[model samples]
Target chain A: MPAIEVEGLTVRYGDLVAVDRLDLRAEAGRILALLGPNGAGKTSTVETLEGYRRRAGGKVAVLGLDPARDHAALTRRVGVMLQRGGVYPGMGPAEALSLWAAFYPRPLDPAGLLERVGLSAVTRTPWRRLSGGEQQRLSLALALVGRPEVVFLDEPTAGVDVKGRQVIRSVIAELRDEGVCVVLTTHQLEEVERLADRVVIVDRGRVVADGTPAELVTRGAGRSIRFGAPAGIDVAGLAARLGAPVNEVDPGEYEVGAAASPATVAALTAWLAERDLPLADLRAGRERLEDVFLRLTATGGAGDGGQR
Target chain B: MSSSPAASARQPGATPPSAARQLTRALAAQTAAEARLTLRRGESVLLTLAIPVGLLVFFSVVHVLPLPAGVRRPVQFLAPGILALAVMSTAMVSLGIATGFERQYLVLKRLGSTPLGRPTLLAAKTLAVLAVEVLQVAVLSGVALALGWRPGGDPAAALGAVLLATAAFSGIGLTMAGTLRAEVTLAAANGLYLILLLVGGMVFPLSHLPGALADVARALPSAALSGALHASLTGGGPGGGVESWAVLAGWAVLAPVVAAFTFRWE
Candidate 1:
């Protein structure tokens, strides 16, 4: 069975439906990245899976057991790293980690986990005294100490520094290598590209797109060639010769929306030569994940456009 | 990389210990950590330990209030009352306020999501409160003994009363902590502590109050605890009336049950 599964999941807060009929599955030895704009039900879905919030409808199973009814048994097999407020303000990292480790049947050594997270030198520092990056690193360490079969991380690198982010990435990779199912939600598209094996994008409490990074980038708005030339070129004439839609996105910047085959390149070169329009620069590119994300999520606001 | 046994032991498939063993260890660790934190806070120390000892010594040495018909010494009337107050402050006021803030900061919510069950967490907290009460009893008894105070009643009865008082107060405290906001719990706990001190016959005898108020005071858990302690400590043979035990027992059973049902983790 898949390590984690959800079917027809629905979550509502009074009159507001935070997550509506969502389905997700993650197998062992894989990373499933949940990406979405703010207020798109990413947190609500993850929280339901973790058994922190009650489900309004449908089924959610982790390790083949109901998360809510079998919470104690499920907790032993799964780990969760929240967005904030898990550690005591005045407690040191060693104390907090060791306290959490006691709850597990067999746990990683608190000291060793701290060193692995690059927090050995500051283990004695109180949680409130640690920097934001250090706190994030410690939180990650606590989540891993349980040696869980499945782990859910929300915004794992939100405030982490470059070195801290690298450590987290390596740790996540190691967990995946060990056949531990991992599900993470993050806004860093670059991190998603580097770490995710499967991507599920949510918008307005529904899955808008779900695929691998390569598949998502190549699926819609296929291969294109962009060039910089003089403004006001013959757009209608170029369309007839190339048999593709050409758009002048900006002044002097033109895009040809079609595969750049040898014949197409040669034809375009001849056409430009005939007009004596000097092509300053030209490169073939595919649609970026960020571009797709923005196009799918943008309604009117820049970033705050989603059901909350 | 596999040269060291420690490295091999750190592998992912290391077999877990029994669940019972893990729960036991978690409870011990949580209790110790809670006790250590309570001891470290200067304000909590003042409320739980210092104030009770201070009252015991000051009342034993001075004659500030008029003596009742049978009471010859002020300490005879004050020691048991102070002991009851100690339990109320530690188990009710201090525990409730601390737990309320812990919930507010999401500490309880985080722990609740872990392998440690809610019942285990509550057990750990109760154990921590008892550990601190041990220290409070020792210091208060020592002060009272130094001032020539002697127990004239059954030691077993006194022990039972203290335990019952602890349970009754802790139940109410956890109820407040679980149901109310942190700031609101803080204010309400302090307010109840003061009110009980005045009317529950902790610093003064219930007889000093007017007729109706005196009857009400006698029915409260605080007054019940004080009356039981006084009877056992002063050779009065469980001086508390039947209504006092019934009141204390009722609170001990009802408050925790209500809290378990109504408590919010976050």
Candidate 2:
């Protein structure tokens, strides 16, 4: 069995169906990124798995235990890091960690975990008095103090500073290395690409895409050559010379798709030089996870999938 | 989904201290945290300890109450009433307001997600409330003794009466805090405190009011507590009667049961 599983999961809020027939599975020793646009039932589904919400229909399990039924048993082995407002405003980081450290069967040392999350400097600062990044770090530290087998992080790096993000990423990487199942929801595609072993994209409460990050990038959210050049260039002329499709993605920025071949790059450079148009910038055969995410969840691109 | 591996094979990691401490430690540590927080808040301290002390000192000195003809000293009457008020301040007002804000700030929700769970959390909170009440009783009793109020009733009975009142008030407070918004709870709790302070027969004689109003006030939880405390501590006052214990016991049982069913952890 996978570390976490959900099949035909349906969640509703009175008359509104929030999560509809959602399905997901995650395994140990890997990181799965759950991504979606706002109001797409991501929070609902995650909260149900965290046992904070009642599922309207379907099966959901973590560590082979039903989250809603065996919640007390499940919470002991699962670490859930909420996005905000978990600590007392008057309590400092060390104090809060120590307080929660008593909740599990075996917990990491509060002082050591604080330092691991780079919170040693602010161990004595009140939670409310800490900066946004410090608060995020403290939240992450609290989640790991339980020494859980599986961890759920909700936007762990949403507002974190660069240094804080680095600390969080490293700590998460360490968790994965220790064979912990790490499931997280984030809007940061770059973070997903850098850290996630698998990406699950949901749109309108349904899983639109699920695969390894590389598989996702190549799953018809295909390879492209994107560069900056003068506005209103002869995109059609370039497409014909390169035997590909070209478009000005934005003013003065262009994209050449259809494999972004080396021969295409050569022809494109040659064509640009023939017109004395400077090749301002060029990147070849690189596909971004953001493109896949956007294409899968675009507001107007619904049902179109936008695959090549 | 991978059927290839064990359901969840525990892997190697840092060895941390054993957790889910025995229930005794959970209760002790959580009670300490709760008591520390309740005492640490300047406003809660003022409301719980200082306000009752100030009221006892103020009313004993002011001579504003219409003391019935046979009463010997003002402190004799005011001490028990103020002590009852102290219970209300701590259990109903201070605790209720704090929990309201905790729920609002998602503190309760976060704690519920842990293994401490809801029942243990409530138990810890109750134990903390008992600890604070111990201080309230000792301080109020010392001040009363200094003011020449000679006690003639059972100290054990007085303590029992206070415990009964504590349970009733805590239940009512939790019900309010759990169901209402934090801001709404704040407004309503303070408003209830002020009303109970007057109608509880604390500083004045209930009999001095119109017959029907006095009878209604006598049935209020504040009145029941004051009457029970008076019967146990200072012998008997206008509000004191055997029926007071029955009324307080009724609420002691009913309120917590209601709260147990209605309270929302989140």
Candidate 3:
């Protein structure tokens, strides 16, 4: 059964529609990445799912409870790491964990949880004394304190450095392995590509694309191919010779799409061999999720008269 | 949603902590945490304990007011008034300023997101304030006694007066803190404290005020609280009776309700 289900969700801040009609579902033990740009209502959607905001219109269920109606119950079952939260100045990181533990029925031991977030060494350091990355790690611990079945992480690694980012990804991955439904929202394309099992792309308050990473990139977003032609060879002539639709996205950089991968590679290699063209640098691969997001969002914005 | 041992404790046939016990334990833990933080912060500690002591000593030693004929020394009259000010200062100013900063820091929002509901949070805060106020009253009473001041009325009534004053001022303080910005709350709390101290008979008798200001002072919670304290402590002067109690009670009840409605978690 799905851990979360939202049907026709609409949320607005004043006259600005933050989340246009949207639908999404995340099954238990799966990582669903809600990807969107800033101001794309990612926070609003996450907040709504966390029962932090009231939806203008929608039918929503989190852990089989209506978020708007059973907010306290849902909150207990679902853990959330908000983008920014209040930290008391006097409470050390360890003390904060202890206090939060008191609120839950059964919580992770403070030491173990601290170690999990890499905050064990600074357990006694006040929150204000921690570095930015350390504070983010502490916030992650708080989200996991309740041993919640579903965790909602909103930009969990926004300001984190490379190592910290990897730690966050590992933590999310571990949570999923533990049978917790992880709804990860981030603008980091690489993080989504690395961690998400399913991708939900939202733009301007609507879901523009949703599928597995490979499926979305392969199906609609075009692929890229780069190869070296003879020094005197014409790039456009190479495109015609290869018998495939191609475009020079940049000087010396070309992108192409074909129905069959092996056939396309063979055709390109054969064409090069026939011309005694040494393929100095050859590159071919499926389209990236970033390209898919940018193209879909860019196309929509352009179609809507560029207001976006 | 996983059920553990605690879940079994909440099952239909299992025993649960009584409501009173739960409230007590929660209130105790909350109060202790708040109090520890309140004490560790130098600024709040000064505001809570030092300010009251300083005002008491300055007014008692500086001879700020001339005593009426046949009345005891100025310290006798000023001591009870200072006690009322202490309660007002701690409950209203200290609570207001602290809560404002707490709100600004999103501490209240974070707490609310937990199982610690608003009522428990309020109870905890009130208890913390009261604990400080209790120490304030005890220390002030001891100092005043050393200065040869003695209450000339019913002992229980004087204690009752102190308790009432604390309750009333705390309500007003929490209300103002919950409703205003930290900067605005700090300013308003200090400004209101001074206004009440001067006009509401903390430093001198309301009888000494001009007719119009004295009338306003009579309605002020600080004045009512001071008046009640004075009537009990000095056992001489215009007795506050039920009217003063009512004024203080009005503030105590009304402030918190308004605060609850207006407070922002963040």
Candidate 4:
């Protein structure tokens, strides 16, 4: 059995349907990154699998135990790192870590874990006083303290500095080597590319794509041109002129996730030149995960563009 | 698939202690941590310790308020009411408002995910409240003693009244914190403190009010607790021991049950 499995999961808050029949599976010894735009129901899906949410309908099992029905048993094996502010403001990381460690039968050493997370210097610093990077590291430390088989991290590197990112990345890579199942949700595609073994993109409460990072990168494998321009550019007009689908993957960032021959590049540049638009960063390569992501979920999604 | 080779090698859940043992260990550890957190906070110390003592000392010496009929010393009547106020402050005003903010700040929400489940968390918070209540009672009684106020009546009953009143006020506090927004709970807790002090007869005598209002005031959780404590300490008076204990017990049970049903994690 997969370490984490959700079959036809459905979650609703009052009248609004947050998650609708979503299914996912993550294997042991690998990191699966769940990605989505804001309000795309990623939190609802992750929280339901963690047993914090009561699903409207569907079956979710972590380690073969029903998350909602067998929550108490599941919690023993599952560790959750909330998106923000779980530690008490008044408590220092040292005291807090030791207290949380007492919950598990045999937890990792709090002091060693602190050092591993690069938090030895600020052991006595209260949670509120710690920088955002330090706090995220502490949260990661707490999540790992239990030595849990399955760990759910919400935006582990959202506001982290480069050193903090390196620390988190190394710890996560180590978890996979130890055969732990790591599930995370984040917006940083670079982190996903560097850390995630499998990538699952969720949009409108469903999985739009699920595969290994390499598989996803090459799934739509082809020569493509990516560039940065002012946001709200007429993607439809550009696609018609260049005969390649153009999407604003992020605000003011565009991706052309398709065949981009010499003609297409000249056409794109000419189109910009006619409007006196200075082309920002430009790249010609195989479809990256970001291009695939934007292709799968753009301003409208699949079947939402002009040519190619 | 079974767990990873490395994970399975650690003898996961193999030699763990019994469930009861783990829970007991968690409870003790959490309580100690909570106590430290509670005491270190300036606001917590001020609410749970300083203000109650300040009210008791100020009222006993100032002699500004009129005494109830048949009451000889100001400390005799004011001591019981002020003690009840202390419990209310710790249970509802101090702890309850903090818990409401805890919900907003993700303290309670994050803790909920751990093996130290909601019941254990609630128990830890309650024990912390009781610890503060114990300190408040000791300091208040000491102040009352030095004020030349003779405390007579049922010592055992006074202790019982304190415990029951703590339960009742904590139930009220949790109810507000779990359901309402933190800011609203903060405002409401302080507002309720003042309301109870005036109307619950903790400061003013119940008899001073109109008959219907006095009857209602006597039945509130605050009034019931103070009345029961006063009756116990004074050896017998209009504080009305037996019925007040029953009223407090009722609140102690009903309010928490309601809170258990209504509370939202975040």
Please tell me which predicted candidate would have the highest TM-score against the true structure. Answer: 2
Candidate 1 lDDT over B77-160, as tens digits, reads 888889899999999998998898899878887787788888888888889999998988888888877777777777797788
Alpha-carbon shift of residue A133 in model 1 (angstroms): 1.8
Structural similarity of chain A in candidate 4, as TM-score: 0.81
What local lDDT does model 1 show for residue A167? 81
Query: In model 2, which runs have C-alpha deviations exceeding 4 angstroms?
Result: A221-225, A239-245, A256-266, A283-286, A304-308, B1-21
Q: After superposition, how far is residue B134 of candidate 2 from its true place, in Å?
A: 0.2
TM-score of each: 0.89, 0.92, 0.88, 0.87
A161-253 in candidate 4: lDDT tens per residue? 999999888888878888889999999999999999999888877778888888887666445678888888899999888777888989888
Q: Write the per-residue lDDT of candidate 2 for residues B135-229, one digit (tens) a residue.
A: 99899889988988888878788888889999999988988998899999899999999988888878776778788987888777898998888
Docking class of 4: acceptable
Query: For this target, which candidate reaches the highest DockQ against the unseen true structure?
Result: 1
Residue-wise C-alpha lDDT for candidate 4, range B79-133, written one tens digit per residue = 8888888888898788878889889988887887789998898899889988888
Clashing pairs in 3: B92-B173
- What TM-score does each prediction get for chain A alone? 0.88, 0.90, 0.90, 0.81
Clashes (N, CA, C under 3 Å) per candidate: 0, 2, 1, 1
Report lDDT (Cα) of residue B239, candidate 4.
66
